[model samples]
Target: MTLSNLNGVPGREDAVREYVQQQLGGLVDDLRVDALGNLIAFRAGRDAPNGKVKERVMLSAHMDEIGFLVRYIDERGFLRLQPLGGFDPRNLFARNVTVQTRGGTLPGVLTPGGRPIHISNPEDRSKVPELRAFFVDLGLDAAAVRQQVRVGDMVTLDQQARRMGDLVVGKALDDRASVFMQLEVLRQLTGPPRHDLYAVFSTQEEVGLRGAVTAAYSVQPTIGIGLDVTLAVDTPGVEADEAVTRMGEGIGIKVYDSSMISTRWLVDEFVDLAEQAGVAYQLEVLSQGGTDGAAIQGSRSGVPTLTLSLPTRYIHSVTEAVHVSDLEAGVALLLAYLK
Candidate 1:
């Protein structure tokens, strides 16, 4: 429950920025909100590395989550949505939602148009609706909804973070879990860092890594570490080889994904450090996803970059799950590496 549950779309990350800043308090040497809504926190090291000028180390985690924005309100008070990030149409059905309006937040139910089981034919029962076919029912008159909600208002899944056994599940776990890791690391951190540390809660990462692209250019770090969630298809129906990572295994030292390949030396160094620190870890090669590391790797003249991924299941859905032991292992590895 300590994890932040605020709603943030790709381009709109103001609330998330504020929440991170509030959590940081006076722990950081400098904290600022960038033009692109990235929350950049600086922590200076005590001594330069090997007597040379210290290099900056960038640790990034995106704060944005997949959600929808209101595009139109029909005459019957049904809200049409434009997705802000990738979504599987099959998972979005009869979901409770919160519409963030200018006036106030409104409760609604997201339901795709389809025949009920009682009156449905065999084809209707088996049919799957497209993402565009879904509508939000606010149970209000069209005129009243129009007066309160604007076209660009955000809508997020209505769910609370919960603990089940050793696993935590809820909406927005994709990046918020990483955010919580950053927060816990900052809290337990004691002395100066080895390099100038910049913890960036980047925005618009779900859309196209927009915030990280700009933040990396501005920071021009010597090392970039992307902290995000990776696929954990350790459940039923998934092939053993296709399970990129397994839940509760440990932290994932990402080697390659769709966006970028990790710097080999850095990957090796992290593996060595994890062994030295006795932290549980796994090497991951995601087949089809990218993280902030790609943006940082492509930044001005490039930087040595890698990703530390937390294995997560059911990503981009309300029921995303992450293991507590894996989360702790990720924090332990990060702390060890920073030391």
Candidate 2:
């Protein structure tokens, strides 16, 4: 919940780093913030053959989420924004948001530059606004807002994490759910890992897999696992075949995505591990989107990599949802493989 609240757009991940370090500082062998703002934590393995660590395994979950960056503040105290990542524009209508300023957080509402429905013609009422048409109303005078808010301040959706029966719903759960899963894996891991472990809370993935590329090159691990969220389009009006994953089914062992295909050997190894461990698992092949594993796999001379995704509904929106059981299964499978 704390992680999901932080404003971690592409270049704005300081709050996430601070929160991660504070929570995980004492648990790992070494913790450091890299030049690209990736938080790297190491845990030495004690179960190596010949008492020497043979392989280094990297685990990554991006900390950044889709957000808006303040661009132009008009004289009317309305704030214009440039998106830091993808937004549907349909979700930008009269939504509550928080602007992270140097002085303090300011509350605001996002509204598209359009006529009110009551005052609009039929043609105007049917037209959807473009991304550029959106602006934030801070409810303050132009001069007062200028004094407190600056250009490049990140604006994130105002939504609190909540449990809804079998699911958890919130904004920024696209990756923070995985971030929390990583932290839980760290806490619940019982014995020393078989390979030296590098758990990296990566930055700037919502923009592109930027931090993952840099961190993967620096670590140069033999194996990498990218933790992320995948579409769970199982709701009404969507066909079963079109649904990439079903919520509460199990952990997703990704086979392919638009970015990268899983290493065949690595996929086989994970399947074997899941079967042996008696963990519920699913084979995922996302036809459209990508994850940090693509960057990790393409780094240096290239490393074997795959992603484990949590099935999420309404991605890139304020009301994203994830099944608690599926989340736990993802953590369990990854933890077992790491062990």
Candidate 3:
């Protein structure tokens, strides 16, 4: 199986799911994709060296990324889009994008319709570009475009994963980076698990924790750990207090998000394990956005839920950045917890 790049870059989940299944092989005792298309991977405690029986543990990372969906094609052959996830209009203008159409993937650039900067006055510059004002140009005529693309086709920003100094940058790193960590944890995990383990790769996380809600109810694990990306506004931010985390620090032990408040014991356990394992970490309390942990926490009878996050910069944009050290820290903590 090849690598799956399901970072909402269009048609990524199928590849990711296939790669995971192949990697698990005989190790995965059970695997199933739900109606919502969440890939559930199961491995047992008995498979470990100690073979001690333990309750189920759920680990999840969202597979969805914020992107555009083709909604309308005007007579001029420009395609209008509807956002599949939250996006800042400021980031949309003059950005390159890839459109997945009926014919194939078409490369294009998204630009807002307005006067060029050279001709525009300062007042025009001050005007914020509404999302609806943007359109993608594929350099094709109307007939050609209509034949190649269709409404509801997927569109993703043209971004590539690359090493930027000590960090990785690309779109969808908000969760794709977390997904990579979860896979690494599964791969490098040598210790015996104490309980039935379910590693869930969920969908539609960008819009809300919708996929997680259903997946958690199905697994009903005693504990749930939502793997995600937290803030790293270490850049030239307006203020430092708002920066929830620091890049290269380590995994983030999330204290709060809009959707869920982490269980105290679970958060403490993560903290202790990180310390004992010599894993670098930071405490996070995000004032905005949430992850799958909330859905798992709201599951039947309420599961003790926590989140481990990789610190990220430029979230929901074309070039989300995450430090390698932070991802390593997440793996370290997760491995320690499994032990």
Best by lDDT: 1
The residue ranges of model 2 lying beyond 4 angstroms of the native Cα positions read 50-53
What would you estimate as the lDDT of candidate 3?
A: 0.83
Query: Over the stretch 1-339, how does candidate 3's per-residue lDDT look in tens digits?
Result: 012134353223555566666766765668999988788988776453455447789999987778888999999899999887778898887898888876778989999998999999999999989999999999999999988998988888876677789988887787878878888888887645656789998878877788888899899898899998887898883488988899988889999999899999989888888888899989999998889999999899999999987899988887788898998889888888885
TM-score order of candidates, best first?
1, 2, 3
Better of 1 and 2 by lDDT: 1
How many residue pairs of model 3 clash at the backbone?
2
The alpha-carbon deviation from the true structure for residue 123 of candidate 1, after best TM-score superposition, in angstroms, is 1.6
What candidate 3 gets wrong by more than 4 Å, as runs, is 1-12, 47-53
The order of the candidates by lDDT, greatest first, is 1, 2, 3
Compared with the true structure, what per-residue lDDT tens digits does model 1 show for residues 1-339? 444378788877768777888999978999988899999999897686475877799999999999999998888879999998899988888899999988878999998887778999998878888888899999899888988988999998877889988999988888999999998888878888777899999999999999999999888899999999999999999899999999999999999999999999999999999999999999999999899999999999889999999999999888899999999999999889776
Off by over 4 Å in 1: 2-4, 49-53
Which residue pairs collide in model 2, if any? none
Q: Which candidate model has the greater lDDT, 2 or 3? A: 2
Model 1, residue pairs in steric clash: none
